[model samples]
Target: MSKINKKSMGQFFTPPQIADRLVQLLEQQVGFALDLGCGRGQLGKSILKRFPLARYVGIEKDREHFNHCANLLTEQTIICADVLEEKALSLISDFMPVDTVVGNPPFLEIPISNHLVLEVKDAIPNFLSSGYKMRSEMLFFAKSLKQLKLGGQASFILPKTFFISEQYRYFREHIIDNFSNISLFELPSRIFSGAEVSTCILYFNYRKTKNQQLTLGCIDANGDIENYLKIDSAAAVTRMDFSYHRLMSESGIRIEESETIGSIGGLIHRGNMSRNELVRKSVPHFHTTSFPINEIEISLDDDVKDGIRFGQEGDILLARVGTRCLDRQVLVTAGKRAITDCIYTIKLPEADIDTVIASLSSKYGKLWRQINAKGSCAKYLTKESLLNMPLFN
Candidate 1:
């Protein structure tokens, strides 16, 4: 597929090996299966190979991909329709109580400002309780699970954020309250031939009640499981990403119990974006790109200054997003500066903050970041996760 169409559609065709791996994540033999957004039937083919008798149905929305699936899975049902549509979902319910549902859905957000967004979200009742910023992947996931039988299972490759970001806290709690046999882990880089986005496999069974144990894995460099642990689902509901869970499970103490960067006033706030016009005398704002940032300017305009969280001399700035440059920290100087949204700032006494920054830049500190930083590629650090960091002990 052309790179342009690939991104515009938000569909990444699964590699053959990855498809086989996803099929293997199914714990039991499949009697009936459904593949959501079954790009080119890669997963459907795997499902058939694993369970020849499994009544397989593959759904694809894109015309080209649907055509490819139609030609490839001739013996299986290939529906050429939008999986998020009510009609498509109702059709899938025909095979109610499906034994398995598998697919790698797209990860893209719908801006609430769009006129169609309200109608676009009308099909996803599960997300109604959460924020308006709807993600396509989560929509598919919620709908897929609704059709699951009592003991039915599901496996989907999802963006790393689904399991970690606080914005999706509602869904995490939903999973903890409803599923069982949950196994989640980061996939090795380059799973998609050219796409470097981070992703993980989520495999679980549907259960009316919670109390399921959760298994988390850390992938080794060679695309294999390096280490893993099992914890109660209740314990991990707030954050399902492995890194933070592992850190907290082993050594993370509570904000009240531990001496942490938060011990001294905590992270003040994320840097605000430069909202005003940058004229000759306009305040200059530094963002993730302005790293090695010398002291900068905060917007003092009536419209922006109130929201501007100024950086103090003893303040430390950390890049909040990106794959390569994330975790980059800068010690703020006395000069005035405006910070962009991509930066998180903490204010402390100069010497104390310096000591903390030095420790965070240390070898183990790097390891802490390497482990706790979520995402398979464009890794990120959450403010709560950062504030929870243990002081040098």
Candidate 2:
């Protein structure tokens, strides 16, 4: 497929092996199956091969893919319509309360137009509040759940961020509260040929029951099971709230509980300087960068004083942005310096700044920051998230 068409339509066909694996994870007696964003019907073909009698429906937005799916799976129903549209959802709703739902939904971050946003609100009123920015895959999950019957099950190939990123916090909470038999399979990175995004397969049944625990596992490139861990549902939810690093880490070592940076007499906050104000003041504004920051002399006017994040000699500066958060570039200043909003200033008294920096720069500290940071492309750690970091004595 042309790159332009693929990008515009969010059409990334599932690999045959992965498709078979996802289908195998579903119930053998699946009465009816619906594949949302069923690009070229790879998943549908897998499902039919497993259960020949299974009533299958596939929804594809791209006309070319829809035509291809129609030809490939002539026995099944294939609809060419936007999955987010009310009309399309209505068509699927006709197959209401499907027993099994599965697919790799499109992953896109484009803003939903106001008109389409209203359509989503009307269709799945309680899915998410209006005006909340969310990825296209999340909408697919919500709609899938809405279409599923009680005791129904679903397995979706989702970006790893769905389990950890703050943007999906509420969705994670919803899954924890509402779903049962939850299983997470952490697939190795680059499972998709051209896609760089890390992915995990989420399997859950739409039922309410107590004594719920999650089964977590990792699979290699060839789909071999590596290791598995069973964790209490509540514990899994808590870890996901902070970061998935500990839960998803191959090491599988539990993070030792310790006092947070806030409890250790460290004050953490973001820089508050405005660009216009900082430009005129000529202050040495430190941003999250790989290169060293050059010092710039600034006349400390009252306005500039209020804007610049002035750091003391012993204070630690860390990048608050994604991936960069793991860099653990905790700068122990030789003297007071001007910092920018991209960096977080940590003021610690009575504690050795060097010792703290060393600990945070360790493997454990890197994992902690990775989990706490938010966002997919521009990940970052909020002040509250940074303050919650475990401090070593």
Clash number for each model: 6, 1
Q: Where in model 1 is the C-alpha error above 4 Å?
A: 90-94, 111-132, 208-210, 219-223, 249-256, 266-322, 330-345, 367-385
lDDT of each: 0.70, 0.71
TM agreement with the true structure for every prediction: 0.77, 0.77
RMSD of each: 5.9, 5.5
Worst 10 residues of 2 by lDDT: 295-304
Kindly report which residue stretches of model 2 are placed more than 4 angstroms away from their true locations once superposed.
Answer: 1-5, 8-11, 89-96, 109-134, 159-162, 165-170, 188-195, 239-257, 269-312, 322-325, 331-333, 336-342, 352-355
The TM-score, computed over Cα atoms with residue i paired to residue i, of candidate 2 is 0.77
Q: After superposition, how far is residue 77 of candidate 1 from its true place, in Å?
A: 1.4
Error of 2 at 190 (Å): 4.3
- What is candidate 1's CA lDDT for residue 91? 71
Residue 329, candidate 1: C-alpha displacement in angstroms: 3.8
Residues 143-250 of candidate 2 have per-residue lDDT tens digits of: 776678889899898887767655556666677787888888877656776555567888888887676878777767776667677777766655442235443354
